[model samples]
Target: MASDTDIGSPERPTRPGRWRWLPGSRLGRLIIVLNLVGLTILISGALVLNELRRGLVNARIDSLTTQGELLATIIDQAATVGEPEPMMDGAYAAEILQLLSNPRSQRARLFDAEGRLIADSYWVSDRVEWRTLPPARTRGDGPGLDLNLSGGSEDDPDSADAAKAQAALRAEVNTALRGVHWAGLRVGVDGERVVSVSIPIQHVKAVLGVLTLEARDVDEIIAAERAALLPFILIAVAVSLMSSLLLNRLVAHPVRRLARAADRVRLARARAISVPDISRRDDELGDLSRSLEDMTHALSERIDAIERFAADVAHEIRNPLTSLRSAVETLGLVEEPAARDRLMAVLQNDVQRLDRLVTDISNASRLDAELSREAPTPVDLRRLISDVVSLYQATARLGEPAVTFTAPEGLETVMVSGQEGALGQVLRNLIDNARSFSAPDGVVRVALGRQKGQALIMVDDDGPGIPPENLENIFERFYTSRPKGTAFGGNSGLGLSIARQIILAHDGTVRAENRRRDTSTEGDAPEAAGDIAGARFTVILPEARR
Candidate 1:
């Protein structure tokens, strides 16, 4: 139930779960997933490119090993100088190296058994120097080693490893001198990678010279590999950007607008809720917009009903208040005892009327809340009508109207689903209304029957029939069509209206119509053929499921 403070007011406080931050928002989470997917795609592409690079370099190294073997065989026959030390014929080997080289791709070189350079395709030299003077360096007192100033400190691990690596020709020649072929990837001093292969020229265990093949364009190969990955990179970037834009336009912006609209509702600047244009879409956001609008509209209607009910309550209470005030004022002015007694009676009646009106108004106002709190259950119309009529019979006076109940023959039960307490009150109200209209010796009969899959309850009174025009008006609030000589303020005039409201809430119908006399003839209107005998009220309710 809404509190008095919240009723009919736009300033009612909202719950705390509405304000969420960016990462908690729907769009933020979507963007996070998109970015994660893009990162996965990028990492997967990099891994693929890395594997491709390794395969290409390994294949190149194998190719160089094969080529080096072929060149070593050729050099063994061509290199025939210095038999004791096994030197290479510089001119013949140089020609072979030049023929084997593929310009900037692979380099071919020949080294003597003594690990001296014999020929090089890059140098184009017929005969390379067998020995060269060492570079000038400062003497270190700690050891006999010389530190070349231009080559950096000899103690530096990077420099020392780089210097050892730069002697690729000597390392291959030394390995080949041991009569073993060497081929694999090696890092150059400049941090570039190369595929190197070295093989020795030998004739029956007599080593001649070493032939080495090195592919120095590994950087270009890596560059090509990266170039091949460009498409995947571009696609990942495009998808990320597209997803961001789509989320912002379709989700984030609309949600933000909804938040702003909710803020406006919180501020109570407007009675209606309005979201963004996204409500036009046929999606979840649109559903949310429609639901919010409907909720606000319902609240506004409830507030209006409350305001009207309050006004009606004030008006109803004022009439009796005005009477009570007038009676009290006149009681003091009246000097005669009989007139004073009349004034006192008037005051008492007004007070009682005020109390009755207040009680009925309270019940009518709380009807909605009370009905909502109570769950509906199957109510046997026969039993219910019997109980209400028995109560009225017990309370009936000697000269008052007598109440009786009748049910369909052989019909064991006619049940409808509703709050039994509320429906019982409905019965009491209808019976009381019927008794009030009936003559002193008249009968108020209640009947229960089933018709068209519905439970029907009819209350009949042997009294003057309702006016044709007031048949409908009789069910309206504050509408009373009492007979002459009846005590004023006897009825609060809300019983019928409250009854109708409760029946409607239970998905039932109630209406007032006059019963026709037995003299009515066929093919003639009831009023034209026979006079109206008495008033009859029929209540219809859906039969309860078995």
Candidate 2:
């Protein structure tokens, strides 16, 4: 079971793990997205081109099969001879093969029923097969190659390749002789890839020969498809590079500059962080930069204030210590009883002063901690002021000033948002200061009311008003300027200062001003044109919203 404050507190963010490196920074994420976009396009193009290549290969095989079937049928009808056991006429089939035109990229071959070659489209059409020959071997190129000089013999590489090609052709022809059509990819005699289709020539269930058609332009088609994909690859690469450069300029560099500025502050090279260029931007980074600058500035001010406070404490404590030392030394030197008694009285007064100063200093030092530790809540000013005045009335002595409280007519309470205890301490300090300065038999008035949108509490006393120039300085630490006839060493001067500090912590203001009265009438005294009546201390706090 957690309290509301604990439940609402934000948890600390966890650091990223080592394996999650891809999304570590803004630039890294941007680069991933940009590169992925290019990769997606390149992959899609490759997939489409692969499908096109498959389709082209299938279409080429089908076209060859159709052409081969028609030619086989024509040859079966025109060139088959003999009764019942019909056989192909090789001479006539050769003539028919020569008469029919084939595509330049395609070749047609014919074989007899005994698996013997009868005609070839390339030879019948007199189509010359052109190929680049390897360079002739020089006599000095190798040491032992000259022993086997014969070319195109049974032991030659070309002879072995030709024999292998003939065997594969016979195998294809043998399958067609069984009256089955075979169509697929195979290596041609020149070791180039081709789509080949074999069809059997038949005359009324009598097998005669086989005709095979091959398309040898598959490699060229695939090369063209690869060339078409080059432009997509280049575009994708260009997009990725441009995106990387843009991200570095827009996001990476500025963030780097901010990091450097923070390092400078941490290293004590600068008192406060200031990056005007980044701060001027209208974005979250800009807000962050400005916030850093403000935080540093505030911390610097607080450090300076603490230094000043330390110096002040040392100076204030020295005075009482000096007096006490002097009094102690004089009491031991005096011989007569009356003189020794006077020295003893001086010693006691110095001791009391030191005690008062120490106590006030301790409270002043703890003021900041107390204010920070306590949270603010709505406080009824009427009840707080009434309680303070009642406490003073209960402890009043003979001939002392009386404490009184007043609120706005018809208003039961005036509310402000502040720490109740701290606010009560502020009211008590103001009331005590007023009572100390008040004239004998005079009343110290504590008034609470609302003005505009603020809750105003004013403490007034019927005594000699403060000097106009010393009004602001009165709230400064250790600034005590009591009037004549006031008891000596009775005030520590930290009361008003502490009050002002508490009011400021609550986002309120406290100020001292003299109450004046105008006596500019015909019967009035001429010297009393404007008389200072009393000193008024007003504390203004923002009204708590309903």
TM-score of each: 0.63, 0.60
Per-residue C-alpha lDDT of model 2 across residues 1-546, encoded as one tens digit per residue:
122211222343334443344442444455666677768777787867674677788899889998998999899889988986788899999899888899988988888787766777777666665655545767776532111111112112333554455556567778898999988877655666778888999898878888989888988877777789778777877777677666766666566666667666766778788989889989887898898889889888888888998999899888878888887887778899999888887777777878888998898899999888878889998988888789889999999999998886898988889888888999888888988998778989989888899999999998898997899999999899988887767788899999999999989999999887775677765545568888999999999999
lDDT of each: 0.76, 0.79
Candidate 2 local Cα displacement, residue 227, angstroms? 9.3
- Number of clashes in model 1? 0
At residue 199, what lDDT does model 2 achieve? 95
Candidate 2, residue 352: Cα displacement in angstroms equals: 2.3
Clashing pairs in 1: none
The lowest-lDDT stretch of 10 consecutive residues in candidate 1 is 148-157
Q: Estimate the Cα RMSD of every predicted model relative to the unseen true structure.
A: 8.6, 10.8
* Per-residue lDDT over 1-546 for candidate 1, one digit per residue giving the tens place of the 0 to 100 score: 222221233455633332233343455456756676777877687967675577778888888887778777777777666645565676787777776645467777677666656666656635332423345556762343223211222122235545555565456668888999888777654566768888888876877767777887878867776788778777877777667767767776677666666656766777767764766789998998888888888888888978887887788889999998898888889999999999888888888888889889989989999999998888887887777888888877899999888886898888888899999999989988998898899998998888889988899998888998999999888788888987778788899999999999999999999987778677987567677779999999999988
Q: Return the number of clashes found in candidate 2.
A: 0
